[model samples]
Each structure stands twice: as structure tokens, then as C-alpha cells.
Target chain A: MIELHNVSKVYNSGGAPVVALRNVNLTIAEGEFVALMGPSGSGKSTLLTIIGGMNSPTAGRVIVDGIDVYSLSPERQADFRYEYVGFVFQQLQLLPYLTALENVLLALAIAPTPRTEKIARAYEILAQVGLKGKEHRLPSQLSGGEQGRVAVARALVNRAPILLADEPTGNLDRATGMQVLELLRDLNGAGQTVVMVTHDPQAAACARRVVHILDGQIVGDTVPAPEHALAPAVLPISQPAIEPCSNATERVQ
Target chain B: MVLLVVGLAIGVATAVALMAITEAMQADVAVKMDEYGANILVVPKANDLALSYGGITVGSAAYDVATLSMPDVERIGTIKNAANISVVAPKLLGAVPLMGRPVLLAGVRFADELRLKRWWRVEQGMEPSEAADALAGARLAQSLAIQPGDEVEVNGRRFRVVGVLAENGSQDDDILFVDLSAAQLALDKPDAVSLVEVAALCTACPVEEMVEQISHVLPQARVTALRQAVTLRMETVGQLGRFAVAVSAVVIAIGALVVLTTMLGAVAERRQEIGLFRALGFRQRHVGRIILTEAALVSAAGGALGYLAGMGAAVTLAPRVANVTARVPWDPVLAAAAVGCALVVGVLASLYPAAQAARVDPTVALRSS
Candidate 1:
């Protein structure tokens, strides 16, 4: 579970200070698929960044599981994020210089798995994301939908508990966006807690719960009916725990 | 990386070349100093008129005819630091008419003169074997159309020229060498010597004290130490070495500045990449290590290439610049030190830039487009 209490963020630029989030309080439980709805300049992304421990709130207490994440040192918070959270950005932040396989492997670079196990896990995640044969393609070579799949593969490579996605489908076409939304819903069905911020109501409709934000405060939180959601039959994304690579291919060639 | 390597290479090459040339020059200077013989000269105390205008000696030099006795020549050996004296050659100078031209003759002991003038080269035959045998100077031999085994009349006596001395662009090239006793007998000045040339180990001994001792024993003779000429030669060589070092230091500073500025720009350009690394769980020290590793690789390669280029420069340019025989001294310690200096410079130059890369805020860096 992730909890945010009295979260506030103030941008202290040269001119008048602008508050991005004000005294926001929210809680997300395990296996919950929550979509944050807000217009431009609302604090949905800021709240997500705070929840992910990627950014510090000017005033807040963020508790993940039983421990207050904000109370830990900055380095400890980064480690907490690395172990507990996987981020998928709206812009589809795949490193341009690295290939699709390498992009997914980055999450495993700091993982405790053996080098060969990391590669196998990375390959499994890419296969799960529907990018089996395109693993070696650079971002520029992949289509918009393919790149989006690569981003999802990177987030799922470590199998972290909570996935924080900001507008994951905002840049895709309608069909591709639906495909990505379906992927998220499948992952949510498999017991991964997901908190997403999206401007498209159709995108939000795929989630089980919706929270509306205006200005810097949450206005309403609601759980939509299952029939009213736009998602197709929610298929589960089952990724079995993989076995370690055999010693024959154990060394990283 | 290319820019960094190029900058470091320029600095390393300059430093290595300077050091190599300086060492070569110092070695050459040592050999030249050894060859610098006759640090003191003892001349007869006489009222002499050296009638010269500009640089050319006009008419004949007139002397009071005062000469040093054989006892005065032997007294130089008993000076205070007399063991420091290597050679004391007594010489007699006279002018003789030969083949309708006046030729100057120098009378010196063969062994003492050879020891005092290590640079002198004999082109033909050996030194005079008897009083009647003479060694003709190169220019005198050429002008008289004389060679070894040729006989020339000097002071109404036939003297055989046993050898021809190589030209040295000095007064020795215009004079003939003979035995002191022969000159004294031929000139009718028995038991008299003109002056003495002494080669002393001035660097290891107190030459000034030796001069004072010699003067105290023979107060009438002038004993000059030739300190000005020696000091001038050494000072010029030392100045060249200092100048090379100063120029090298300035070049190194410029190279470091180039590295600093280039690294700063690179850090600025890679702000988003650094932020991504931080977001991926890299510590600040890890980020710094990545940057420092890049610099180390570039600097190491640059140092190696620069060392080669520096040796090439020294071998190609040292002789032309300092007129010294030059070779790249093969010393592994020196090579390692040179490369180590380059590595230090590269690391130090990247310190602020690496820190800047590590200090980037993930929030700001990730937010930037």
C-alpha cells in the first residue's frame, strides 16, 4: 500500500511562487488500478512523482507498505524506488542510444540477479510486451506503438509491486492507445498496483477507480462499474518466476 | 574524447620534448666542459703595445722583451692545490721570415699541449720528433703549399714539417708548432720562455686560490683564471633549460583549460542522461566514477601517443636547436611518470565537471524536454 498525506509542492521560480499540489491526501492499496483524472496544469503528475519518491513534496508524509519513505535518506529513497516502483512515462522515455533489449535490461543492471538471469528476465519481459523479435531494434527504428510496448517492457522487467505511469497512452493513436490500456489492465489483473495520470476519459475508463483533480486538490474519487469500462475482457498477465540460466550459457558473452 | 586526448597530447609532447632536449644539452655541456682546457693563463709581465683597430691587429705587437725563466715555469707546480693542476705547458712565440712571408711559430711540449687541447685534430703525420721537425698549421700549410715530409727554412735553418694541424678558425690555424728549445735556440734567446698554459680542474678545486698562490710566487707574472668565459657558457646553457621548462608549463596550463571547458560543456549537454542514471538508482559517486573513467582512458592514450611524439621531436629537433647530439633516454620510470602526470591533470581538470554531473537534480533534469 502507498499513502500520501498533506502533500504540497511549490515551484519557487524567479517570479511569484506557484503551488503544484496543495495538502493532497490519497491512498492506494495492493492490486488496485487507480487512474488520476485532471486537466493541464493540475497536480496529478506531481502527486504521482511524490508517490513514486522521484520528487520530494514541500510538505508530506509518504508511507509505502509500513515505512515512511520520505523519512528515509535520499539515497535510501532511491533504493526504495528502485526495488518497489517501476515508472512508465507519458513521453515513452526509452533511451535513444540503446537498443530495445538493452532498454529493458537497464532495470536489471542494479538488480541482484546473476548476469545471465538478468538477460533471460529481460528477454521474458520483452516477450511479454509483444516485442519478441524486435528486441535489438533502436527506438528510432520502432513504431510509436512498438516504442510504447518497449517502455512497458522496461517498467515490467523488474516486476516491482507498484507501477507509476503518467499519460502512458497520451502520445499513441487511438487503436495503439487502447492496446496499451489493455496491457495495463492485464497487469493490474495480475495483482500489480497501478496509479496512472491521464487526460483522456476513455483512457481512464479502463481503470476500476478514478480520482478527479482540479487546481492542486483532489475533487472526487469514484469506482466505476465494470460494465461501463471501455476495456475488453481483462486478461491476466501471468509472468511465471523464471529459472536461472544453465551454466552452459551462464557467462555474459 | 578526441578533444580531450588532443589537448593532453599537446601538453605531454611539449613537456617530454623539453625534458629530453634539456637532458641532452646537459650531457653535451658536460662533454664540452671537459674539453674546455687551459682554465688559467700565465703571461710574462711586460709593457706591450697591442696596436689594433676594430678587431684586426694592425701592425706588429711590440714587447719590452721581458721573458719568464725556467724556474718561473716550474714554480706553477708548487701552488696550493697544485695536485689539481693537470697540465702546465710552457710556450715560446716568435716570428720568422719563410718563403718571403712572415710566419708565427709556437714552441710547446707535445704531451702538455695535447692534454690541454683535446679538441685539436692532426690531419697528417705525428708531432715533431726532433728540434728540426715542425707541425705546420692547416692555413699555413695550404698557403705555403706544404705537406707532411716537406722541408721549410725558418730562422736560417731547414725544418721538416712532420704534420699539418686541422683548421680551428683561430690564431692556431695561422701558426706553426715546434719545440720550445728549438724556438729558443733558433731565435737566439736561450733559457727563456714566453708564457705558460695551465689546465686545472677548476670545478673541483679552488682555482682562485691557485691563481693567488701562483701570483704570490711570481708576482711579476699575470695569472688570470678565465672565470668569465666559463661562467658565461654554463649560464647560457642553464638559461636554455629554464626557458624550455617555463614554456612547457604554460602549454600544460592551456591544455588543462581546454579539458576543463570541454568537460563542462559535455556535462551540460548530458544533463538528462545523468538524471536518467540517477533515477535508475546510480549513486552520485557512481556517476562521478563513470566520468572519471572516461577521462582516464582518454588521457592514458593521449599520454602514450604524446610520449612517442615527444621523443620524435627531440631526436629530430634537438641537434638543430642546441647543437647537441640528442637521443631519447630509455627510462621506464620517466615514461611512467610522464603518463602519470597526464592522468593527474585529466582527473583534476574533470573534478568540477564531474561534480556538476553528479549534482544534477533528477526532478529538474527529467522535467526538461
Candidate 2:
């Protein structure tokens, strides 16, 4: 279980202090897929980063798997994150110089696995993400949705128990975004705890629970209806014309 | 990375070239000194003054008469650094009437004098090898209209002219050289030498120490080192070496400064990348190792190329610029030292930048983009 106790973040820009999060407290259970929903400047992304150990809260206690995450040294925290958590950003932060398969292999840089096994594992994860034949393509050569799949492959390559994705489908079209959402739902159904931050209700509708935040504090939390299921449509990014069935709460942007 | 490597290469090349040229200059100077003859001059402890009658020299007046004996020459061989004594030749001088004209004659140990004056050339015949044989200077031979195999009458005694020396443009061009014993017998001075020409090899010795030793053995004679010759060569070669060192230091400093600035800029530009690495579980040392390894690799390549370039510059430019044959020294130790120095400079200059990269805050850096 991941737990947060009175998490707060303050940023000093220029000279004035800006509060990004204020006394935001939340907990996530194991094997749970939760979506954090908020408007802009609502600290939803900050909350996700704090949980992922990417950012340190100004004042809070973060406990991961019963171990106090913030109490350990920065080095140990990095090790903990590598061992237990993986991250996917909206920007598709794949290194431009590396190929798709190389980007996925980057997650195993510190993994104590044999070189041949790591290569095989990276290939296997890429194939699972529906990027089977495009492993050698650079990020610039891949389409937007293919790049997103590469990012997903990198996050899942290490097989970390927790996946923190901030705006995973924010840059994709409705059909492509739905495919990504269905992929996340399938992973969550397979027992990977995933915490995602999104503004689209259709993406949140796919999660098991939704937490609402405003002005750096959680205002609402509820379990949503299981209205979205894995689409039977073969939503390969290469066949963009084959649109998958949409969720009930799909919002047009 | 290219800029860093080029800068380091320039520094290493300049340093190695300077070293090669300095070595060449020292070698050339040694050869020049050898050609200039012995560095130490020995003479009897007496002052000779020409007595004049009506502004014309009538006779010679000496305050004291002292001479170096053959035993004194043998004692000179027992100096502290006896092995450094390369040449020891004693001379007996006198004026004798030859062809009704008074000409000065010098008696020298043929072999020792030949070794001392390595630059001397006999234009006609070989060096004087027998007691009765004489070698005439160019001017003296020309004045007498002499030829090899002819006999020169000196003091009613005749000596065979074996060879005529080429014009050296010095006092040697105006005198005649004969066997030491023959000259001493002709001049009526038995077992007496006017002066000793001692060439003390000072390649690794203190010149004054050799002089002092010679003086201790022959206190009756005045021993003097040819300070003018020694000082002239030392000043020229030492000044050139010091200048080379100063220029090399400046070049190396510029190289190091360029490396530091380039590395700092690279780290600053790669903040997000470094933060990502940290986020991926790389510790501070691991990040530092990455940067240092890159620097060491570039520096080693620069060192090797610079060594070849330096040798090329030395062989092609030293002769024209320094007027010395630049012998390219194939020294592995020097090459290794140059490369090691470049590595040290490159890695040391990158330390602060690597540390700054390691200290990048993952949260801020990740959010910046």
C-alpha cells in the first residue's frame, strides 16, 4: 500500500512563495488503478510526482510498502523507486538519440540481469506493447501514438509493482487515447497498481476509483462504475482507421 | 567533445615539440663546443713584457720564469674526475730563423693536439707523425713557397714538411707545428712545456671543479677555464629552453581552461538527461564516472595524435627555425608522461561540472521541460 500523510509543496518563484500543494492526504491500495482529476494548477501532477518519489513534498510523510519513503537517503529513495515504481510522462520523454527498443532497455540499466536476458526481456516488453516490428525506429521516426506505446513499454519493462503515469493519453486523439486507456486497464486488471493523473472523464471512467483535487487538497474520492472494458477491437497504432468503441463518459476536446 | 580534444591536442603537441627542440639545441651546442677546442687553458706563472727601444720591441722581458714539467702533466691525469679529461696536450713555443726570416714555431703532441682541435684540416698531407716532420700553417707555407716533402731550415736544422694546414683564420694559421720533443730540443729547452691545453669534458661536471683539481696538482702554473666559450653556449641554450617551457605552460593553461568551460556548458545543457539518469537509480559516483570516462577517452586520443604531430613539427620545422637538426626522440616514457598529463588536466577540469551534473535535482529538472 502507498500512503501519504498531510503532503504539502511550496515553490518560491522570483521572490514570492507559491503553494502548489497544501495538506493533501490520500492512500492507494495494492493492485488498484486510481485516477487523480483536477483543473490546471490544481497540484494533481505534483501529488503524482510526490508519490512517485520524483519530487519531495515540503511537509509530508510518504510510506511505500510500509517503508517511509522520505526517511531514506536520496540514493536509497532512487533505488526504491527503481525497484518498485515506474513513471510515464505526457511528453513521451523518450531520448531522441535512442531507438524504440533502446529506450525500453534503458529502464534495465541498473537491473542486475544478464545482458542477453535484458535484451530478450526488452524485446518481449516491446512486443507486448504492440511495437513488435518497430523496435529499431528512432523516436522521431515513430508516430505520436507509437511514441506513447514506447513510453508505456519503458514504464512496464522493469515490471515495477507501481506505475505512475501523469497525463498518459493527454496528447493522443480520442481513438488512440482510448486504446492507451484500454491498455492501462488491462495492466491494472492483471494486478499492477497504477496511479494516473488526467482531466478527461473518459480516462478516469476506465480507472477503478477517482480522486478529485482542487487548490492542492483532495476534495472528493469515489469508486466509479465499471462501465469501460478492454475493447475487442485490434487497436494497433498502424491501423488508425479502426476506431475502438468509446466509453460512456468520453468527452470531446 | 571535439573542441576539448583539439585544445588538449594543441597543448600536448606544443609541449612535446618544445621538448624535442630543446634536446636538439643542447646536442647542437655540445657539438659546437667540441669543435671550438678545449675549454681549459694552462700557462706558466710568468708575465712576458716586450722591452721597447724607440717604440720598437727589441727583446722580451719576463718578471718570473716558470714552466710545467712532464710530471706536472702526469699529475693532471689524477684529478677527481679524471675520466672527464678528454684531451691533454702540452706545447713548447720558440722563434727560430727560417729562410732568413724569424718565424714562430710550436711543439705539440701530434695525437693529443689533433684530438683537441677536431676542426683542423690538412689541405695537402697528413698530420705530423714523426719527430723530424713538420706541418706548416696556410699563411706560413704560402709565405715560404713550401710544398709537401720539402725541407724547412729552422735554426740551421732542417725538418720535412709533411702537410700544410688549411686556413683556420686564427693564430694556428701563422705558426708551424712540430713534434713536442723536436721543438723542445731545437729551442734548447729540455722537458719544459710553455703551456698545456687541457680539454676537461664538462658535459656533466662542474667546470670549476675540474679547474680546481688541475690547480691543486700544478699550483706553480695558472689554470683557467675558457669562461667566455662556456658562458656563451650555456646562455644561448638555457635561455631557449626556458622560453620553450614558458610558452608550453601558456598553451597548456589555455587548453585546460577551454576544457573546463566546454564541460561546464555541456553539463548545464544536459540537466534533464542527468536528472533522468538519477531518476533511473544511478548514484552520484556513477554519474561522475560517466563524465570522467568520456574525458579520459578523449584525452588519450588527443595525446596520441599530439605526439605524432609534435614529432612531425620537430622534424620539419626545427631545422629552419632553430638551425639545429631535430632528432626525433622515440621515447616511450616521454610519450606516456605527456598523455598522463593530458588525462590529469582533462579529468581535473571536468570534476566540478560532473559534480554539478550529479547534483541536479530530479524534480526540478524533470519539470523544467
> Which predicted model would earn the best DockQ?
2
> Cα miss at A233, model 1 (Å)?
22
lDDT of 1 by residue, B1-369 (tens): 788888788789888888888878877765565466777878766665353211222222375544576789999899878898888988877788889998887778877888788878889988767878888889999999989999888887678899999998878888888888888887776777777878887656687988899999888787778777777877887898899789877877887888899889888888877776676666677778888888888888888878888878888888898688635475566578668878888888989999998787655433636
Expressed as tens digits, the lDDT of each residue in A1-253 for candidate 1 is 8888898999887898999999988888898888888898898888888888778889988899987988888778778777888888777778899999999898777677899999998898888877888899999999887888888888888888988888988888876777777778778878888899987777777777778788999887766444443332332323322222111221111
Ten contiguous residues with the weakest lDDT in model 2 chain A:
A231-240
- What are the lDDT scores of the predictions, listed in order? 0.78, 0.80
Local error of candidate 2 at residue A19 (angstroms): 3.1
The 10-residue segment of model 2 chain B with minimum total lDDT is B52-61
Mind giving the per-residue lDDT tens digits that candidate 2 earns over A2-58?
999999999898999999999987888898888888787899998988898868899
lDDT of 2 by residue, B1-369 (tens): 888788888889988888888878887777667555777777766666343211212223256566787888888899998888888988877778888888888889999989888879999988888889999999999998988999987766679999999998877877888998888888887898877888876656677888998999899887888868678787888998899889887887887888889888888887877877776666777778888888889888888878778878887878898898636566787689778888888888889988988788766434637
Name the regions of candidate 1 deviating beyond 4 angstroms: A110-117, A224-253, B31-134, B138-150, B153-159, B162-174, B178-231, B320-324, B328-334
Q: Is the docking of candidate 1 incorrect, acceptable, medium or high quality?
A: acceptable
Write down the TM-score of every candidate: 0.73, 0.80
Q: Give the TM-score of candidate 2.
A: 0.80
Candidate 2 Cα outliers beyond 4 Å, as residue runs = A99-102, A111-150, A170-182, A199-206, A213-253, B42-83, B109-115, B118-152, B157-169, B179-193, B206-224, B364-369
